[model samples]
Target: MHQCAKEEKVRVIACGAIAREIIAICKANRLGHIDLQCLPAIWHAYPEKITPGVENAIAEARAEGIERIFVGYADCGTGGLLDALCAREGVQRIEGPHCYSFFAGNAAFAENDDDVTSFFLTDFLARQFAAFVIEPLGLDRHPQLKPMYFGNYRKLVYLSQLEDENLKRKAKEAADYLGLEYEYRFTGYGDLTSALTRL
Candidate 1:
């Protein structure tokens, strides 16, 4: 996952999907104290890999003499396994059940009922729609499978970390592809800013 120089920087074991956003936030805030390490973003399709991957990253960080570590992942479909790993290792992860929740602000996202049947996309998801979703889900090869996979999903909500027209268009195209309604929400970093700044 990561290799460090046994310095004073705080290591961040994070989800690769938000790696760009993390770099953006750190740069904007001048958070030069952090050392960001991300696992493969494709793991979103294989959640069983998250906890074990994070555990290994943690062990590696510790071995590199990095005591101060921050996990930039949410629960991320690992159920409570990530939380258990955090507790057992005495480390802290970003708040919220997943990126959608945290990027929308955890408390506010919890109270929103629209998400019940909404398929979500962040900037990364929008940009990597083909590799992350269409190709991985086999929708590119078997178009008929789209309906079966997204039968219950009513809409696609794109949570934006940066307001970009290209990403918005891509997101809308994804929604159209899936035969779902399109919704765009500009949520810049949300609680992720506060979480990292506090460290």
Candidate 2:
């Protein structure tokens, strides 16, 4: 094992989707002692890839002489596997089922059972709606599949990380594309900041 310095900086292995926000938060809070490494954001669609990807990133960070490492991921549809890996690696991760839940405040999100029929999108997801949601889901090539995919989703909830009107418009447009009602909620990084601050 590569030994680290006495004052080694903290390393965060994160999801690419939240990388920008994490950097912004760290900068704003003057948490310059931390470093971030992100895995491909597209892996969000493939939960099976997330655990190994995170493990590899952690190993790389460790090899780079990082003594303290944190994972910036939620369960993210990995079905407890991410948590298991984190435990085995003796690392910590954000608390929630997914980014949307944490951004909404974990406790509050847990209490809001009514949102089960709603689909969610964050700033990154809103920006990459075409590539992430539409193209990968094949809704672009087969518009007819929209109803089948979103039939149970009565509303599209845009969980805004920043107060950007452009992202809001895009999220609304995404809602329209799926034929679902539009709702907006500004979460502003919620628990992510607090979690990072703890480290």
Q: List the residue pairs that clash in candidate 2.
A: none
Q: Model 1 over residues 1-199: C-alpha lDDT tens digits?
A: 4332344689999999998888888888878788999999999888899999999999999999999999999999999999999999999999999999999999989999879999999999999999999998998999899888999999999999998999999999999989999999999999999998898
Model 1 off-target regions past 4 Å?
Answer: 1-7
| Whole-structure CA lDDT of model 1 | 0.92
Clashing pairs in model 1? none
lDDT of prediction 2:
0.89
Q: Report every candidate's CA lDDT.
A: 0.92, 0.89
The TM-score obtained by model 2 is 0.95
Candidate with the greatest TM-score versus the true structure: 1
Error of 1 at 187 (Å): 0.4
Per-model TM-score on C-alpha atoms = 0.95, 0.95
